[model samples]
Target chain A: MDTRERLISSTRELLWERGYTGTSPKAIQERADVGQGSMYHHFRGKSDLALAAISRSAREMRDSADAVFTDTGTVVDRITAYLRRDRDALKGCPVGRLTQDPDVMADPELRRPVEETFAWLTDRLAGLLADGRTNGELDPRLDPEATATALVAVLQGGYVLARAAGSADVHARAVHGALGLLTGDARRSPSGQENR
Target chain B: MDTRERLISSTRELLWERGYTGTSPKAIQERADVGQGSMYHHFRGKSDLALAAISRSAREMRDSADAVFTDTGTVVDRITAYLRRDRDALKGCPVGRLTQDPDVMADPELRRPVEETFAWLTDRLAGLLADGRTNGELDPRLDPEATATALVAVLQGGYVLARAAGSADVHARAVHGALGLLTGDARRSPSGQENR
Candidate 1:
C-alpha cells in the first residue's frame, strides 16, 4: 500500500486499540513503517490523520449496516440480521468507541464522523420501521423514531456491558432480549400468561 | 480529609475525566495536593489507588441505582424512574466508562469492580421484572433476565450515543424509545394501526 494509505490504516487500528488520547504519532509512524518526514508529508499531524481514519471508519460502518438494511426480508428481519451480525465484542465498535475518548469528543472535526454515523444509523433504522408500519408488519402504535433510537443504543451499549464483564455471552444475551422485544415474543413469558 | 481520602477522591475524578491511560500518578498527586511519598504510603501505586477509587465509584453507582429500584412504585414505574433519573449525560457512566480503558480491562484486579457493578445491576433489574410478571403487572411472556439486560444496555449505550453527539437529547430520545417498547406503547405507529 502507499504511504498515505498505510498511515490511515495504521491510525485506524491504533485508534480502535488505544483510543485517540492513548495513541501517539510515534506509534503511528512505527506501525505504518513510515518515517516522520513521510508522515508529515502525508498529513498535518495526528488529529488530521485521525480525522481521515475516523471518516473512513464511519463510511465503512454505514456501508455494512446498509448491506443488512437493504437485504431481502421484512423490516423486522432486517433489523434482526443487523443485530445478530458477527462482531468482535471485546474490541467494541470502531466508531462508537471514539465517543469515550475525551480528546476525540473535544474536537468538532474528530467528533463529527462519530456523530454522523449514529445519526445515519438511527435514520436508516427509523425508515425501515416506518416501512414496516405502512405494510402492517409492525404495530401501528410503534413510534419509529423512538424505537429506532433504542435499537441503536442496544447495540452500542451491549459492547459496554460485555466489555465490563469480559464475556461475549453478555453481548449475545442483551441482543437476544432486544430482538425478543422487537419481534413481539417478549410480550409474554413462556408460561403462557398474558400481560394485562 | 486525610491524605488517603484526598488521594482516592482525586484519583476518582481523574479516572472519570481523563480515563485510566490518560491519567497519571503525578496528576493525581497534584490534584490531591499530596506528596509522592504520602501517596505511595497510602497505596502501592496508581493501580492500587485506582482500585480503591473504582470500588468507591462502583458502590456509589449501586447505591444511586438502588434508590430508584427500591423506591415505592409499581415495577414499570420504578423502571421509568431509573431511566428518567437526572444525569450528566455527556460525562458518561463511571463504571461503564472504565470498560473502554485497555489498562483497566487488561488487569483482572482493576476490572473486578466494573464487572461486579454491571452484574449487580443486571440481577437487580431482573428481580424487579420477575416481580412485575408475578404480580400480573407485566406480560407473562416477558423474559426478565433478557429484558433487564436490555434495559441496562440502553442506559449504558445511551450515554455512549449522547457523548458522541455532544447532546443530552439523543440520550433522552433513546431512553424514551426503550421505555415505549417496554411499556407496550411502541407496538404500533401513532395513526392507530395494528401489527399483523
Candidate 2:
C-alpha cells in the first residue's frame, strides 16, 4: 500500500484502540512505520490524520450497513442480519468509540464522520421500518424513526455494558431482549411477574 | 482535602479528559499541584494512582445513581428522575466512559470498579422493573433483567451518539424513545404523535 493509505489505516486502528486523545503522532508514525516528516507531509498532525481516518472508517461502516439495509428481506430479517453480522465485539465499534473521545468530540471536522455515520444508520433503519409497516411485518403504530434510534442505541449501549463488566454476555442478552421485543415473544421470569 | 485525596481527584479528572492511555503521572502530579516526589511517595506509579481514581469515581457514580434508584416513587418516576437528572450531557458519563479505554479494558484492576458500577446499576434497575411488572405498570412479558440491561445501554449509547453528533438532541430523543417503549406507548414520535 501507499504511504498515505498505510498512514490512514494505522490511524484508524490506533484511534480504535486508544481514541483521539490517547493516540499520539509518534504512535501513529511508529505503527505506520513512517517517519515523522512523512506523516507531517501527508497530514498536518494527529487531528488531520484522525479526520482522514474517521472519514474512512465512517464510509466503511456506512457501506457495510448499506449492504444489509438494501438487502431484499423483511425488516426483521435485515435488522437481524445487521445485528448478527460477525464483529470483533470485544474490540467495540470503531466509529462508535470515537464518540467517547473528548478531542474528537471537540472538533467538528473530526466529529462529522462519526455523526454522519450514525445519522445514516438511523435514517436507513427508519426507512426499513417504514417498509416493514407497509408490508405488514410491523405494527403500523410503531414509529419508524424512534424505533430505529432505539435499535442502534441498544447495540452501542450493549457494548458499553459488556465491556465494563468484562464479558459479552450482558451485550448478547440485551441484543436478544431487543430482538424478542421486536418479534413479540419477550421472555419473562416469575420473579419479574410478581412485581406486577 | 488531603494531598492523597487531591491526587485521586486530579487523576479522575485527567482520566476523564484523556483516558487511561493518554493520562501520565506527570500530568496527574501537575493537575494535583503535587510534586513528583510527593505523588510517588503516596502511590507506586501511574497505574496505582489510576486505580484509586477509578475506584473513587465508581463510588461517586453509584452514590449519584443511588439517590435516584432508592427514591420512594413508582418505577417510571424513578427511571425518569434518573434520566432527566441534571448532567453535563456533552461531557458524557464518567464511569461509563472507561468502557472505551483500551488500557482500562486490558487491566483487570482498572476495569473492576467500572464493572461493579454497571453491574450494580443493572441489578438496581432490574429490581425496579420487577416492581413495575408486579404493580401492573409494565407488561408482564417484559424481562426485567434484560430490560434493565437495555435501559442502561440506552443511556450509555445515547452519550456516544450525542457526543459523536455534538448535539444532545439525538441522545434526548433516544432516551424518550426507550421510555416510550418501556411504558408501552412505543408508537408515539417525539412530537407526541402529531408527526405521524
Clashes of each: 14, 6
Error of 1 at A194 (Å): 28
- Share of reference contacts kept by candidate 1: 0.75
Candidate 2 residue spans exceeding 4 A from truth: A188-196, B187-196
lDDT of 1 by residue, A54-129 (tens): 9999999999999999999988889988987888878899999899899999999899999999999999999999
Error of 2 at A62 (Å): 0.3
Fnat, 2 decimals, each candidate: 0.75, 0.62
RMSD (CA, Å), each prediction: 5.2, 4.6
lDDT of 2 by residue, B37-141 (tens): 999999999999999999998999899999988889888899977865666656778888889998888999999999999999989988998998899987788
Each candidate's chain A: what TM-score?
Answer: 0.94, 0.92
Determine the C-alpha RMSD for candidate 1 after optimal superposition of all C-alphas: 5.2
What digit string (tens of lDDT, one per residue) describes model 2 on residues A1-196?
9999999999999988888887889999999999999999999988888889999999999999999888887788999788666666567899999888877777888888888999989999889888887999876777778777777888898889888876767777666666656655568332221111
